[model samples]
Target: MIDAGSSGSRVHVYRFNYCKEEPQLEEEVLFHMIKPGLSSYKDDPVAAAHSLDDLMTRAVKMVPEELQYCTPIAVKATAGLRLLGKDLSDKILNQVRSHLTENYPFPISANDGIQIMEGSDEGVYAWITVNYLLGKLKPSQRGNSAAIFDLGGASTQIVFEPVFSTPSEKMSDGDHHYRLDYGKGDPYSLYQHSYLGFGLNEARKHIKERMVDQWMDDAIKTGRVYHPCLPANHNETISYTSKATTTTNSQPEPIDIQLIGTGAGATQCRAVIEKLFGKDRPCPTSPCAFDGVYQPPLTDTFKLRDLYVFSYFFDLTQPLGMPLEFSVAEFGALTSHVCDGTADDLLKHVPGAWTSLQSAPDTCLDLTYAYSLLKTGYDMAPERLVKTAQKIGGVETGWCLGASIAMLDGNQLCKA
Candidate 1:
């Protein structure tokens, strides 16, 4: 399985055992990534498809030659391509399909095999990956399953099996609700939604644009704008791009300017990030998350279920002395230390994160955004315990494994 994400493209080659009713993931034969994702070559679809050659070659070698003819291959592009709109994304997908079909020994389904994955399916697949890895999909662990919060470059997703108290209670009809049977047990009624523009990288771009809008005149005059989200002594040139698109174009040239850091801490940075949520928008449906999107109350629906947060959530926290499991309040405190302190202060308090801060000065903003995203955006409780991990057991944590299972179950490639 190939995950063509916003920041990069990753390939996961798996060898599964089909002895059980459900396919058992024996081992992840190969896992590799290439940067500047397929979307980077927006002007040239061929190059975008060609970018996977190295990774594909490596993956092909992982499967035994005898089984190559029976193995199936697929490419699923995420928000990166989704943001490119249909015309351009389709071109990239077609090129990718042609490349794989013509060269690889692996089987590639003519339809619905290599394409841009729907946001809803990405979330559901990731939910399955986490739960299955933790052994929560077994019949004995039915009610003890966990929820998932995935934060990517261009989008964020939340998914969980909401426990309804009354038989009459039903999740309101919308894109946020998903029902599925993992094939081992009864179908699950899950609450899932993918927020398109609320991802960490996308949020940074939105914040930069807002800052430029507020400080444009001053920046143009002095060539230096003060930004509160960055740490002190951190200065850099950043692009503030507009989301507006014309009939022929999806990404417009950005407005670039020099930014000087003020290190004002999480208070002001949180305020800036909060405004993007559209919290004030009128919600026709009750119990809404940010941007007037419907959500079953997290507190009640997912009361005792464990919450597994990965990707950006794990990347930002683990280096700062945060444990695998921590409460919302603990995360907030770490955000404060990172956002409010300087380079020297970081060396004194969070020495391990100092080097990372220097490389990415917007560490403060990233940390603050993550904390606020959970505390304010999702409205999670201060005491809520969430686990962060890049891997579960020996397998890397993401949606690829689960997607492989789905394909095998459909008899797409696996004959067992």
Candidate 2:
């Protein structure tokens, strides 16, 4: 299955066994080279909409037709959807919707007679990934409680969920062992949230609006694009620690986020963590616990990795007069040359080899670009974000598995 995301898209070939009740991985790869996200619409959405046809054509080429497994294929679009105006969105949807029906045998389409979701879909995916990380998806498992905070190029979401161990907990069947209630929290207290901000572009806008003079100063000196600022000191870190959770509050605890996801600039996050600890959080010295990363979504599996993502969210700023190609996925540099936000920037990760954006050698740190946007003008962090991600997972890939559940029936309904 292939999902078109806000930045690019990905294709995965997978199989599952109902008897074993688990999905066995087959093959997967991220096809970011196509860059088929709605971000393309930023310049000329109408033209971008048309361009999707080309992207789809490329997507068609990525999959191998000879695979014989009868897997249910799906195509999902995330954060990027909201970027397009209705006219452009509708046009793009209509075109892609047609392809959904025509391509990949049993193509998964969110348009047509289908529906798309927000937090719920992502929540379910987090459930699966967390299960995989926790090694808890036994046939006798019910579910788990988690807070998901996902930041994407187009949108961001915070999901809250209380997992029910046994899928058939209330069923009158004798297979009662198929239910699981792990050591997390109270079951049946699921919740979630979604925010349009917290993305690279918007976060950048926030930084620029808040530090216009600083950005212009950089532009004048460098005469180049200095994207995504990086945090230079510890005082600038932003705390993702949650203030509440169902376990801690009478009103479902309202999940307080203890983790923040980088989504793009995890490598930078490692730097922040190291600078704070004055030690290499990841490998070379010793993995801080975040090394040997997974599909990027399964970050929770690592312990003590509480502050890895959020390279730009802290509003960090860089000194003018630096390299030209240095880029960041927003969330960089602090409001002041020195950051006062220690709790906001940090996230969980076992110290290890961090992943960088676009892995090419040319891209360095880009907190300055984001700072310029923020100093200019844009929305701040979305409301009720931390809580939502608790239920759902961060937005990257695999959110579809959740969407396949929560948003399927317009509510949370597990697919048998």
Candidate 3:
């Protein structure tokens, strides 16, 4: 299974034990990732398919030569492609389909094998992945299932079984409710929503735009701009195209803006990040999450229930010596430290911690944005405990596992 996500593309090769009463995933035999997702090749789609050459070669070697004929290879794109118009997305998918059909040893079932996945389906698969691994998928164990908070590059998703008493009909028309069977004992209903433009990278872009718009006049006068969310020592020259003043060319001209950070820490950064949540927007529904999105009230059950937050959430925390089980307040304190500390100070505290200096500049902004997204956007309690990790029980913690399971069940490849 190939997950063509916004930030990158990853392939998961699963080995299943079909001898069991119900098929079980014995292990994820091979997993590989390539950067700059298929969306990056919107203009040249053939290159998009070519980008997966290395990953496909690895996949071919993982599956036995004999079984390769029957094995299905599928690619499902997420938010990045969805944001691109349908025509462009289809071209990319078509190119991928062509590449797989001509070059790969694995079976290419049909064009549907490579397509864009809906945002709601992405949320559902992630929810299933977390619950299935935790042994919470059974009907009797539904109440024990943990909520999933996936923070991706282009979008964020929240999926859970709401314990609120509101009738399904009472939910706003926009709410997504799914009845998933997964070849299990019984089906269960899950409430899931994906918020576009709320992902870490998208939020950063929004912050940059807001800062530029707010400080443009002053920046033009003084040739310097201040962003509180950035690290104290952060300095960058960003170019933005300005509206044409005259009609002759009517083409926007690019202008370079200098951004310098004031030593303001998390307190100020939080203020900037919080605005992206659109908390002030009025909702037509009685209970709304944010930006008028419908959501069941977070009752006592929700407050007490466990949550598994992955993707960027795990990426940001794991390097900072955070435990697997930590409270939102503790996470906030950690972000505060990152916000206040300089890049050199951070390295001194945790020697050889950062994997890349390129990402070091955004640590403060990303951490602060994540904190606000949890506390202000999701209304999660500061003291509530949540699990954040890249993997659980030897399997990766993401939608691919659940998606592979769903594909096997749908194709009747997995036994009951």
RMSD vs true structure, all candidates: 3.0, 16.5, 2.8
Q: What is the full ranking by TM-score, best candidate first?
A: 1, 3, 2
TM-score of 3: 0.91
**How big is the positional error of residue 22 in model 3, measured in Å on the Cα after superposition?**
3.6
lDDT of each: 0.85, 0.36, 0.80
lDDT of 1 by residue, 63-181 (tens): 88878888888798999999999999999999998998898888884447888888899999999999999999988888788999999999999988888788887789987878887
Candidate 2, position 21, lDDT: 34
Error of 3 at 42 (Å): 1.7
Q: Identify the leading candidate in terms of TM-score.
A: 1
Angstrom error of the Cα, residue 177, model 1: value is 1.1
- Cα error, candidate 3, residue 407 (Å): 0.4
Model 1 worst lDDT run, 10 consecutive residues? 240-249
The true-structure Cα RMSD of candidate 1 reads 3.0
Q: Which tens-of-lDDT digit does each residue in 27-71 have in candidate 2?
A: 333233356665466555455445545545554455445432222
Model 3: which ten-residue window has the lowest total lDDT?
407-416
Against the true structure, candidate 1 has what lDDT? Answer: 0.85
